[model samples]
Target: MSAASEAETRFEREDTRRRWLLSTPALLIILVAAVGPLLVVLLYSFLAPGSYGDVRWQFSSDAWFNVFLERDIFDDTLAPAWAHLSIFWRSMKLAFITTLLTLVFGFPTAYFIATRDERTREIWLFLITIPFWTNLLIRTFALQEVIRQEGLLNTLLLKLGLISQPIPMLFTDFAIGLGMTYVYLPLMVLPLYASMERIDFRIVEAGYDLYASRFGVLRRIIVPLVKPGIIAGSILVFIPSLGAYVTPRVLGGGKSMMLGNLIELQFGQGRNWPLGAALSIALMAIVMIALLFYVRNASRGGPTHG
Candidate 1:
């Protein structure tokens, strides 16, 4: 080989080495922090549960079987764990509701912000992020104050003669839904706004000039264009809502428990680490399945769309 060519090859190899060296710290951190813990959890899911907070090294399938099948001690026959299934279903249902509600509300807010003048947009964006300034627990408690029996909502209703008495709102499924929506609304809006802002106004104007109605224009043009943001926001809202702990604990009154509550109970009061790990894996599987669907849909829709 020519000396010049050899020098070029040496330079290319050095550049590759430099890139890998720069990325090594992040790779190691991920391996330690994320992969390490996940592996431990996976291993625990297959191990026997200990009397205390420990796990036995002996292999067991009890944790996985406990998800759907339960053996009755009295009859020595296997039966369905309907309670666990119900909890999982409830978690999924609540997450779907939260995602749907956020999408319905967030899109309009995002569109309004996207349509604003530059300085006005900045102000609106800043307002959206104000929720992040306060601690989430404090914000959740503030929501509790607003919706409690003697709180602002009831007080206003009483003064207006809208109700004969204070409504029970603090510890219900409705309150949990409301709190989740409030907390995650910003997550949905920002991505949507980003997508909407990138859209060319001329395309919208063109649609209008072609005699498309407002609703029609939005349905066909705007919605399709911003599909990426909708998916992104839905994911941002859905995954967290499914495993939410604090919001449900504060608002759901512990009576309306979701998967996160179940997991917490297993590790804390329930003292069942193996079951908890199995449930965690199950939750992750659900998320992965959803993500797979999203990826498949995105691929089929072509590169231009989400």
Candidate 2:
């Protein structure tokens, strides 16, 4: 072979080897950490729980079957041989509310930050992220303190003569939803800011130059540009909110028992690994379905004007 052809062949071989070498570590880590555990969970989901809380070698569809067609496990403190589809739907509803609230509050804030002067934007972004630097548990506890009966809010309300007694703010659905929105707001905002910041100013200006109304320009130009961010932020907030344990447990008390809390109870207090595994798999399925929908909608390139 000619030297030129030989060199090209050698370079291609080296490039192939280099690519394989670079990708090996990431592939190995994924196999070991993610895929491996998922396989274990899948196996565990099919097995019966032993007397000592270990998995039995015998296989059973009982877990999956119970999750879909049995008595409501969540109806009482004790395990009923049933599925709690209502609880799943309620968690989804709460997650939806939280997502919408986060979007409503986060969008304008992200827009301003994205469109502002660089240094000022940085400062504002830092301020937005400041809450995240603290531990999430600490933040939730702080919220508990603020919203609890006889807490700061109630104290101020009483001092202002707004009410005769402390409002039932803590241990309510509203409080849990509000706390979730607060916790995930930054996740929504940062993505939105990123999407908005990437939008070309001239496209917006051109819309105005063509005599488009402010609303028209926003509807036609801005929405499409930021749709990805909106979807991303929604998914980010919604999925976690659906499976959230701590915020609801702390803020909602017994009133806002999410699937996460239920699953935890099964694994911990209930000592029902089979049910917990089943519930977890169910939750995972819901999240995956939601993600598929989000991806489908996001990929459609946003809303269209009629």
Candidate 3:
């Protein structure tokens, strides 16, 4: 090789090494701070449960086996863990419903904010984020107050002569879904607003100019353009909704148990650390699958901005 070529290669290698050295602290933090707990949980999931609340040192896949199947203590017959499956299904169903609800509400809210003049837009965005100022638990309790049988909605309806009595709303799947949508709505709105803010409105105008109906313009010109945001918002809302504990706990009143509550039950009252760890891992796997789906869609969607 020529001297110049050799010199350039040597400089590039040094630069790469320097970059790695600079990034070492962040890499180490991620490995130790983040991966350390996960590694512990992974190790715990493979161990036998203690007689009481913790894990034993002995290796066993019984915890994993118990996740999907339960061996009958009497006949040694294996059966599907119907209870666990139900909890898993409920969690996924609630998460999916929450994502859909947030999208339905947030898309218009985002578009509204995006369409506003700059000063007014800032005010609306600020209002959307005001919920973040309160603690999640506090917000959940407020929602609980609103939806509980004797609460605001029923009271107002009763006063307005719209109801014969207080409607039962709390301690149900409906309450759980409502709480999750309320909690995660901002997450959905922000991403959508970001995407919509970058859109070229002239295309929308052109669609209308071409005699496209409002629905047609929205379907063809707007939604396709905000596909990436929609995907991102769904992921943000869905993954967290899957593991949501506080809202479901408060709203469902323990009757409508979710996967998060089930996991907590194993760890806390049930005294099965191995099972809890297994469940934690299962939840992470679901999250990873959602992330992968998002990546696939995002790559396909590409940039939608003008």
The numbered model that scores best in TM-score is 1
Order of candidate numbers by TM-score, starting with the best: 1, 3, 2
Question: Per-residue alpha-carbon lDDT of model 3 for 1-306, expressed as tens digits?
Answer: 999999999999999999999999999999999899999999999999998888889999999999999989999999999999999998999899999999999999999999989999999999999999999999999999998889999999999999998989998878887888999999999999999999978899999999999999999889988988899999999999999999989988978788999999999999999999999999999999999988888887576352
TM-score of 2: 0.87
Task: Give the least accurate 10-residue stretch of model 3, judged by summed lDDT.
Answer: 297-306
The residue-by-residue lDDT of candidate 2 on 104-160, one tens digit each, is 999999988988989999999999999989998899999999999989999999999
Per residue, candidate 1 scores C-alpha lDDT tens digits across 148-258 of 999999999999999999999999889998999999999999999989998887899999999999998998899988988888898889899899889999987888778
Instruction: Estimate the TM-score of every prediction.
Output: 0.94, 0.87, 0.93
RMSD of 1: 2.0
- lDDT at residue 248 of model 1 (Cα atoms): 92
Model 1 gets an lDDT of: 0.92
- Model 1 is weakest, by summed lDDT over 10 consecutive residues, at 297-306
- lDDT by candidate, in order shown: 0.92, 0.86, 0.93
Candidate 2 regions with alpha-carbon error over 4 angstroms = 1-13, 71-83, 161-164, 302-306
Better of 2 and 3 by TM-score: 3
The prediction achieving the highest lDDT against the true structure is 3
Rank all candidate structures by their lDDT, best first, as comma-separated numbers. Answer: 3, 1, 2
Clashes of each: 0, 5, 0
What pairs collide in candidate 1?
none
> What are the root-mean-square deviations of the candidates from the true structure over C-alphas?
2.0, 4.3, 2.2
For candidate 1, what is the TM-score? 0.94
